[model samples]
Target: MAETIFADRVLIGGRIQKDVLIEIDDGRIGEIRINTSGNSSAFRVPSSCLVIPGFVDIHCHGFGPDSFGAGFASARRATLAHRARGTTSLVAGLVSSDTEDTSRAIASLATLTGEGIIDGVFLEGPFISVARRGAHREGFVRPVDLGLLSHWLEQSKGTIRMVTLAPELSGALDAIRFLVREGVVAAIGHTDATYEETRSAIDAGASVATHLGNGMPSLFARQPGPLLALMESPKVSCELIADGRHVHPCLVRYFVNHAISGVPIFVSDCLGVEGEGKHIALVSDRLVEMDDGAVVFKDNGKLAGTALPLSGILKSSVTKAGIDLITAVSAATIGPARTIGLEDRGKIETGYRADLVLLNGTSLDVARVMRCGNWVVEKHEYE
Candidate 1:
């Protein structure tokens, strides 16, 4: 059956188009009619609501392994939780852990990605700095082991899309080169690298700054650490956690506006426990709990992860971080989709996958989500 949706304003091709009519044919966008004369027969978006593409989150946890316990069922639960709330695309995030456990998790998540439950896998580290590890287990931290990296890649069978590592680690530049050649995103994070080291890594094909402003050294005027280097490089995609706590709002504005040359991708970095997935000792097997609105480690009080889902992050990105709606929406949607080479399913354009989200214009609450042209029924009806 064919279906049509009408909205006063719909986000398409990175801008809002007025009075648009989107026709869905066989789960794909068919004809997008702009300046439609108010099709009352079509499913109409509320006047106060904004219709945008479903969100794409490149950095997040709660599936497969590392602290939150193991099992594919748990990973499905995490993916479903995010999908129900409008994050139609997600990259399963894993923290530093034993090679055996990490490989097992990667295999499971690769299966999940194969099944189209999640987008892909992101290994936060087994190759990060111990001092800058933050919530990661220090025992699992080590210098870049090219052999281990190659093993994981072979085990993942192409599901591993992103890997975070420190440039200061031994053989990191070589590993970055290998990852780039293999079509994987080499992300810079959890590092104690200097500006020069970061530049070297970037030049060596490290194309992403994972969760920038966190898991790395602070930016100093005299020192000008990795943060400056990552921001200055034109080839890097900077990942910013948008729960309004990971990076200062002022810094968020600067980064979204002038600090970065590449796309500023907003992420949740939530631990995959439904609401406020916090106060839990599941991240990298490090003892942690929720302090205030943020998740922190129990021993040293460093940030472990976030409790907010991508919905909360989107709301905060606009209301708290002072980022424009279009820019924030792009960060959450197309920017992330384009970063990892997902050419489809992130925008409301012609011939794209009909995945979309409708939100309250003022409050920014997710009113409803439509994945592949089907509206999501709430749990109340499911049960």
Candidate 2:
């Protein structure tokens, strides 16, 4: 099957180009002709529209891989919810859990990965920090346990693509080395690491700073914590959660623009508790709720995670954080795809997957979503 799109503005090569024609053959991009040059009949659109690559959410916890009562059916529903909101590639997130529970979640998510239900699995740690484990249950958070991690990787059948661990934990450097050796990403998150400790981890192989400004200390002038260390490395990837509540809007802007020498990408970090009226769930035997536009722990009133999907996150990123559409879209799309080594999607270039999202010019809202050369959502063209 062949389809052609005549887009007023197409995001390509990290910038926007005007009046373009994109050709698709068998779900992959065939050619991108600039300026159209008389190609007027192919999926016509006005100048008031913008087409960008479909989002790649490397971190979202929405009923995702390893939550309570998570099954293939429920997980698929969560994945589809992200898809409906312009996310073409999603990596289901698993909070820190017991070894047995983690193994089970990995098994289920690994099967989904094999079936193409999700892009991959990100285990956000049984090896993180207990003190900085925001919303991550404390009892299950432990020191870097390479034995348990090895078991998970084997059980995953090569499906666990990323793991989050604190650099300050005992045996963490060795764990980072092992993870890198096995082709898994070693991410620094939920840590109380000083700048020196963080530098050591990065030197050992930690390439990603998981949710950079969150799950870590504030960048105090005297202390100058891990935030600076992580941002100093050009090879690291900083994951930013642009949800209005997680990190302040001002900080979000700063982080997006100036905080990282490394690449900055956006993640939803959704907790899957977003629902009508009110929703409640048990997280590690603690009560968590989503209501009235907030997801929080019932006991201590601490934020659990965002209630929005990637679409809402993007909107907040642009409107609340005062980010331009071009930068915001790139951060959400190509930046994250490349961060996770998914080079085939997140671009409108030849030989890339035809995963694109059409957005309203004025509102920047998702108008239509195309995945694998098929329209997965109802047609809502920019009119």
lDDT of each: 0.84, 0.82
Write candidate 1's Cα lDDT for 110-194 as tens digits.
8988998888899999899988988777788977889999999999899899999999988999999999999999999999999
Cα lDDT tens digits, model 2, 76-194, are 77777778779999988998877777778788889889998788899998788888999887888887778888988999898888999999889999999999999988999999999
lDDT of 2: 0.82
Candidates in order: C-alpha RMSD to true structure? 2.7, 3.1
Candidate 2 residue-wise lDDT at 108 = 83
The candidate maximizing lDDT is 1
Model 1 residue 38 lDDT score: 58
Pull out the clashing pairs in model 1: 67-282
The TM-scores, one per candidate, come to 0.93, 0.92
Distance from true location, Cα of 363 in model 1, Å = 0.7
Candidate 2 residue 185 C-alpha distance from true site, Å: 0.8
Error of 1 at 315 (Å): 0.8
